[model samples]
Target chain A: MNRRLLLVSNSTLYGGGYLQHCQQNISDFFGKQVKRILFVPYALHDWDQYTKTARDKLNSLGYEVDSVHEAADPVKAVRKAEAIFIGGGNTFRLLKALYDNNLVTEIRKRVLQDGVPYMGSSAGTNVATVSINTTNDMPIIYPPSFSAIGLVPFNINPHYLDHDPNSRHMGETREQRITQYHEELNTPCVLGLREGSLLLVEGNTATLLGTTNARLFQRGKQTSEHEPGTDLSFLLTDAQ
Target chain B: MNRRLLLVSNSTLYGGGYLQHCQQNISDFFGKQVKRILFVPYALHDWDQYTKTARDKLNSLGYEVDSVHEAADPVKAVRKAEAIFIGGGNTFRLLKALYDNNLVTEIRKRVLQDGVPYMGSSAGTNVATVSINTTNDMPIIYPPSFSAIGLVPFNINPHYLDHDPNSRHMGETREQRITQYHEELNTPCVLGLREGSLLLVEGNTATLLGTTNARLFQRGKQTSEHEPGTDLSFLLTDAQ
Candidate 1:
C-alpha cells in the first residue's frame, strides 16, 4: 500500500495555540508541493466553525484549506484534493459522518492509491487506523460500523495518559483499557500516543515524531515505551 | 411498568473493598425477602473469579449469591431469580455477552414486568439505561446494538469526574462528553454518576443516593446538581 499519513495525538496542547505543537511537522510533511488541503470536520457538531478553526490555523502555517462540508460533491472533492486533514471531536460522530457521506472508501483511495498526504488529530488519528475501538472519545452516536479507513495496520489511542498514582478515581486507567482491548483482539497492536506525540508514515516506514514518548501494547508481551524519533515502521510491516 | 433498580456508579471506590461502598444499600434494597441474589459477572473477563468476589462480598452482607454464568440456561436463571446483581467491568463486553446469550429481553422483563429487584455497578449500571452510548468503557468488542435494557428511561455515565481547573489534559471532560451525547439524542437524558453515588428506584420514583451529588444533563437544559436525597423521579416519569 502507498500511504503517507501524519497522525497526531492532539490538535491543541496545553499552553499552546491550536495545532501549534505540531505546526512545523505538518508543514514539513505536506511540503512545498502541496498548497490547498481538504479539511474534514465531521467529527464535530458545527462543521463550519471547525473548518474555520482549521483554516485559520493552517493559513498561519502557509496553506489553504477547502472544507469537505462546503463541497457539493464530497467524493469528487476527495479525488481532487492535494492533501487531506481531519480534525478531532467525537470519534463515533466522525465515523458515522464518514459512512453517512460515503467518504470512507474515497478517502482511503486518495491516501493509499493516490498517495495524497493525510493528516489527522485525535479522533482523526483514530479513524486512520484499523478501527476506532481504541478511541478515548465517547460513543455519543452509533456509527454503522466500528471499522475505519485502515491506513495503518495497528490501532492508535490518541491523547493517551498514564495511570495517575495520586488520583482517587476508580475508572480503569488507559493502560488497563488497552489491556482489555488486547483481551478482545490480540493482534493489531495498540499504540498509545501521549499529547505532543505523532506518527509520520511515509510508504511502509513510520517514525515516531514530536517531543513525547509512545506506549505500545501487544498480546503476550510486556507493555513497551518508545521515545520520539524511534522507528515504528515495524508496526506497518505486516497487515493484521 | 413496575421497576426497582439500584444503579451504582462503581463496584469499588478508592480505599475501599469490592462493593464495600454500596453494600449497605445493596442489603437494604434486596431486603429480607430476597435471600439468594443472581450475579451476572459477564461484564468482566474472568467470570468465575468475578462470581467468587461477588459471592464472598454478598455473603458477608447476609445474602446468598448465585452467578448466572454457572447456570446451564442463563435466561432461565434470570427468569427464576429473586434479585439480580450485575457487577462492573467493560461495558462493551457485558452488552455483547447479553446479546449473545439473548438476555437483554429476559433481564428487562424480569425487572420491569416481574418486578424483580435489579442491582448494578459501573458497566452494570450502563446496561440498565436506554443505551450504552454514555458509558466510559472502550469499544473493545462491538455488540449487535448500542441499545441496552431500558430499566430506566435515561442513559448513564459511570465514574463521572468533574473538570479539574488545574489539569492540562485536553481530552473532553465528562460533562463535555455528555453534552455531545445530548447533541446526538437529547430526549433521553444522560445522568453522570460520580464515584460512590447510586440511583435508587422503586416503582416510578427514583432518588439519588450515596455521599456525593449527581449531575444531570438534559437537552436544552442547564446541567443541574442534585443532592443525595433529591427526588429524581421525574427522570422515570415518562417513557422515552
Candidate 2:
C-alpha cells in the first residue's frame, strides 16, 4: 500500500493560533516533494473565509495553497495536485459536498494509488476512516451515505474528550457514545484522538504523534492508551 | 389535528430514579382512556431489558404495558394499541428499527389521526420531529433517511445542555452543533429541551411542562429561552 497520510485530531489547539502547533509536522510531511496543495474547504460553512485562512497559514510555510472549489473540474484539480489538505468543520457537510460533487472515488484513487500526500483535521480526518458513524458532528445534512474514503482501516473519533466525573450534564459522554457504537457495530476499532495528537502514516507504518496519549477502543475489551512515538501500524492490518 | 403527544428530554434526571420525576405527568396524560400501552424498545441495546423496565414503570402508573417486538405482527399491534411509548437510547438504531419494521407511517397515523396518545423520551422525542437531524446521539447506524414521522413541524434536540464556560475541550458545544444544523437547513426550528423538561401537546395546544427553561433555535436569529408553563403550541403550526 503506497499511502502517505497526516490525520490530525484538530487544526488548532485550545487557546492557540490556527494550525500553529502542527506547522513543523506539516512542513516535514510535505517537504520539497509537494509544492502546490489542493485545499478542500467543503467541511466549513464559509468556504471562502476558510480557504483564505488556510492559504495564509500554508503560504507562511512557502507552499502554494489553492481551494478545489475554484477549479473548473474538481476531479481534474484533485488528480493534478501534488498534495491535498482538508480543513475541519462539520463532517456531514463535508461528506455531502464530496458526494454531491462526485469526488470521493477520485480523491481516494489519488491518495491511495497515486501516493498523493493527504492531510486532514477534525471533520477532514473523519472521512479517512471506514465510516463517519463515530463522528461527533450533528446530522446537519443527509449525505448520500456514511461511507467515507478508506484511507485507514479504523474509524477516527477526532477531538475526543474524557468524561467529566464532576459535571452534572446528563448527556452520554464520548466514551459511552463510542461504547454504544461498538455494541451496535463491533468490528472496526475506534481511535479516540485527543487535541494536539495526530496519526502519521507512511506506507505501512503508522505512528502516533503528540505529547498526549491516544485512547484505543475495541469491542468487548477495555480501552487502552498509547503515548506519542508508538508504532500503531498494526491497526492498518485487516486481521484486527 | 387531534394530536396528543408527550416529548420528554430524558427518561430520568441526573442521580434520579428511572422515570421517577415524570410518573405523575405520565399518569395524568394517559388517565383512564389508554389502558394498554405499546412500548418501542428499539433504541436500546437490550430490548428485553428495556421493555421489562418500561413495563414495570408504566405498570406502576396503572397501565398495561407491552413491547411491540413481542407481537406476532408489529404493524397490527401498533394499530390496535391504545397508546404508544418510545424509550430512550440511540436515536439511529431506533429510527433504523422503525424503518425496518415499516412502522413510521403506522405510528404517524395512530398519533396524528386516530388520537392515540404518543409519548417519547430522548431518542423517542427525536423521532417525533420532522427529521432526526438535531439529535444528540451518535450515528451508530444509518437509517433509510434523516426524515422522521413529522408529528411536529420542526425538530427536537433532546437532552440539550449549555456550554461550560471554563472547559478546555476543543469539540463543538451543543449550541454550536445546533447552529451548524441551522446553517445547512435553515427552515426548521429546533427545540433544545433540557433534562426534566417536556412538551405536552393536546390538539392544537402545546404546553411546556417542568421546572427548567427550554431553548429555541431559529436560523440566523438569536436563540431564546422559554420557561416551563409557557404556551409553545405555535410550534405545531407550519407557518414558522
Evaluated with lDDT, which candidate comes out highest? 1
Query: Comparing only chain A of model 1 with the true chain A, what is the TM-score?
Result: 0.98
TM-score, candidate 1, chain B alone: 0.97
Give the Cα error of residue B67 in candidate 2, in Å: 0.2
lDDT, candidate 2, residue B189? 94
Residues B1-240 of candidate 2: C-alpha lDDT, one tens digit per residue? 889999999998988878888888998999988889999999989999999999998888899998999999999999999999998999999999999999999999999999999999999999999999999888989899999988999998988888889988888889989988888745599999999899999999999998699999988789899999999988888876
lDDT (Cα, tens digit) per residue for candidate 2, span A84-191: 999898998999999988889998999999999999999999998888999998988989899998898899899999988898777889999999999975559999
Model 1 compared with the native: what TM-score? 0.98
CA lDDT of every candidate: 0.92, 0.91
Per model, the share of native interface contacts recovered reads 0.76, 0.80
True contacts kept of 2: 0.80
Off by over 4 Å in 2: none
Minimum summed lDDT over a 10-residue window in model 2 chain B is located at B178-187
Q: TM-score of each model's B chain? A: 0.97, 0.98
